[model samples]
Target: MLRRITLISASIALGCLATIGPVLTSLYFANRDVENRDRADIQEFADKAMLRAELVTYQAFAALSDLEQQPGAACSPANLEQAARVIYNYRYVQDAGAYAEGKYLCSPLLGDVHDKDLTLPPPDYRTNDGFLIWFRQKSPLSDVRKDLQIGRNGHYVSMDPEAYVDLIDPARRPIAAIQTTTGTVFAVSAGADPNEMFNAWKHAGDVKSDEWNYAVARSSTRHIAVVVKSPRSSVVGDRPKLLAAWLSVGVIAGALLGWLAYRRVTRQLSFASTLEWAISRRKLDVVFQPIVRLADNECAGVEALVRWTLHEQAISPEVFVRVAEESHLIQPLTDLVLDKTIAQLGRLLAANPAFYVSINVSSEDLRTFRFLNLLTKSLQGTGIAPRQMRIEATERSFMNADATRGVIAAFRAAGHPIYIDDFGTGYSSLSYLQTFEIDVLKIDKSFVDTIAQDTASSVVAPHIIGMAHELGLEIVAEGVESEFQAQWLRTKGVQYAQGWYYAKAMSAGDLARWLGKNRAARTPDSIGGGIATGSIET
Candidate 1:
């Protein structure tokens, strides 16, 4: 009766967990989609603003061309003033002026003006096709024109600040301000100082504030970029609210289901208790999956994989290992696996002392010095050199960089080579290679699987290999289950490989026997096809 109740309760709990996983996964992807859409919206706004700025700049240039076409217009103050008046009338023009040889020759505001002290700095950009220069500074005519000071010469428009502000009319409120590449700030709206938003984008290209997402884009034609931003709340909109609703519903349903399961529970059967029981009973064991050197088909080393069998059912490492981590039983579990692995491979290490064995380490294992001390003592007793034991870590182990770096440094100081497991399947940045002392990177099987398909989409695997090579790190390709994948990686200069194409996890006795038989050069297909199932347990 108790067994029947336990089974029924476990089934109901598993069903609740299954529902929760999909709900959470859906929420995650929905949030990602929202972010991608927001990026597109911001990019489009920047492009449109760029086009508007470019149009205004070109219009000024066209006016300059008209003045230059007029015979002696630049030399004659009357003609120049007349021309300036015509251009100023275009729009947003407060004053117009013509200057040459560092002195104003003409202006509609000041007729026949010549101020020897008047100075205009150089342009940020130049054009040889015409006498044109672009620059920005405080208005020399601030006394006369309260709002006009910034000018663009050669059809120079004496524009008020409103001139720049007006270009962004019917704007997507994302336009916080407009500024010349030459450093003149023009506010587009009256709210929070747009200069602050503009400066953020100018410095970083993209930035986010509590209320807004700021971005900067330069016109292909003009020297300045439009400072575009969107309300942070608008970008996320109601998606987060919807996600919250779904999550709330899921939590309520889970609670109800859990309650029902608990009422039916005959005896408490936690995974933590089961694992501890199994550990004490010595039901856990280690299996070795050979890491073959692709160049010579020689077994250079073996990765130690932990296996657990409880209640006549073989539990997957993914399941039990995660349970161990959550229960804080990982350190003891890791010690057990390592202790057993060394005992089993003691003969192989004695015969070929150079052979290395790789074992996986978690972030929790690295946060403390206990594992480090355990490793040192274990190897010291077994007569295994530090170089003969490779430490493997999934990229998630480095999420807290400061803590991870100390762990990595400790391993390096002890002389154990480090390998990054499942490289392309994590949040690992290219920065990790530079920041951490990594020796080998294992390309995930997902990338290797792509190469077997006859499609252009598979170029990523080769690129990953190329990137790893450029960083001066050795490469290991996982899941080379086909001759095609194997040959491709080999040609791409991948030094090592691990997959069923070489061998599955086996007992020490079975591996020693299989190694004796498979020393010759063998194609991936031949090796994959002729695997002796009776010799090695999957």
Candidate 2:
């Protein structure tokens, strides 16, 4: 009898363990699926919010563009008032003002412009693009409390907070903000006061406090974020009590699964942190993509593209660059790229005196003092002179207007050529050329590809080339992937070209060999000595 009882007890114990194993596994996977779905939902919300914000910004810019298009109206008081009136009649703007040279020139409310420095928050309150937006501010032009204040360069625009209020859905009750690299530009709340929530998020340090925080969604561009006050429980669906019972029955297995999940999350978060370490370890590498001159089919110069590999996996520029910029790792990473590229190309540059190299830089890098210092210091002992390196900035670089112009002036003062990379893509590309001291405008690839397509599509490239030439800025057509496209760009008066049509990116050694092979086919000897490098300013 005793042996039979012990056998039954052993069987029961084994049966229970068998039941727990599958139950725990199911619960773990179900929980993971729920978490992923929650994350996806939040991301979708962020995407929509960002799209809305962009649309609003674009609308506001359109009003300014229309005003700017009227000749001599940008600074004219009546014209400025007309511009402001146009904006004010719309639902978004409360008022508008003309800004130039870091001062307010005119406003609809205050006609006859005086050089009043805008009443602005400090630099910390502004975006990396130099846009300072606020929910409310004392207007230098008027005494009324304005709902939204946006100031960049000498320009300022005031909008009713109600403009942002209508953007979000009624169900989400989200607090949204327009942000840039430096900080938040404009923030608004639909239900609760956004300032309170923003402060809480900024000051909260503990997980307990964070638990009470809103579900946050961010834009891909990292320029906007919408914070929902809804509880996490809404998105993270509540599991039935049976899930807990099953998990409790196999606590040890559940704990092990949780540990695995934790490890996965921590590993993912380490990617951004590891960049600094990677740079210090010399893990970053550089490749040179030759920019050929369409005029002679000779390689004009090369654009340095940064490449990185980690843990035996190749990382694309798109992946790591956004991460670096978001984490404030851009400065260090940029420095690394510049250092490595210059180091690799120093001998080659020394060998070909006329060859110049263009390096891409972020607006943040251009704005920072460290960027200038780094360039000046890095080239001190190198064979390459400042003239041999051109600073390439995107259309976004000019959004800051005065600051960007000042920075470009500084680069020019240091004897470096400044080129606007990916021209014609920006909403204000032409405006930037007219307003800033631009040395070169690289026609965006999209436009170049269309240049030789059909009559309708082909007109854009030629038109841009003509406009750029008219502005006295040299043109470099990008993405000339075919001979037809190249020939058309040349006919349209494009000075330089870059794309696979000439040569894909290559190693420094490979570039040297190509340079030697094609030296005879470059531009006229006068244009950077037929090397298609940088244009020597007269």
lDDT of each: 0.68, 0.66
- Candidate 2 residue 429 C-alpha distance from true site, Å: 3.9
TM-score, one value per model = 0.49, 0.51
After the best TM-score superposition of candidate 2, give how far the Cα of residue 351 lies from its true spot, in angstroms.
3.2
TM-score of 1: 0.49
Per-residue lDDT value at 376 in model 2: 81
List residue ranges in candidate 1 displaced over 4 A: 1-269, 452-457, 520-538
TM-score of 2: 0.51
For 1-538, candidate 2 gives per-residue lDDT tens digits of: 9999999998998898899988888788876676557556555444445445544564455444445444554666557755665565444666777665545566777665565555445433566565665556666756775556666645566666555535535355555564534345356655656565455335421124433334554554335555544434432345464356566748758777887997786565467646655754567888888887666566667899988888888898999898888766676677777887877777767666667899898988665334675688678876677888899988887788766777788898998899988876776556667777778888888877676566565677777777888888888888778888777767778788888878888777777667666764544563445432222111
lDDT of candidate 2? Answer: 0.66
Report clashes for each candidate as comma-separated counts: 2, 3
Task: Report the C-alpha lDDT of model 1 over 119-163, residue by residue, as the tens digit.
Answer: 556544454554444333445656543343333343354444444
Best by lDDT: 1
Candidate 2 runs further than 4 Å off = 1-268, 455-457, 520-538
Candidate 2 lDDT at 375 equals 86
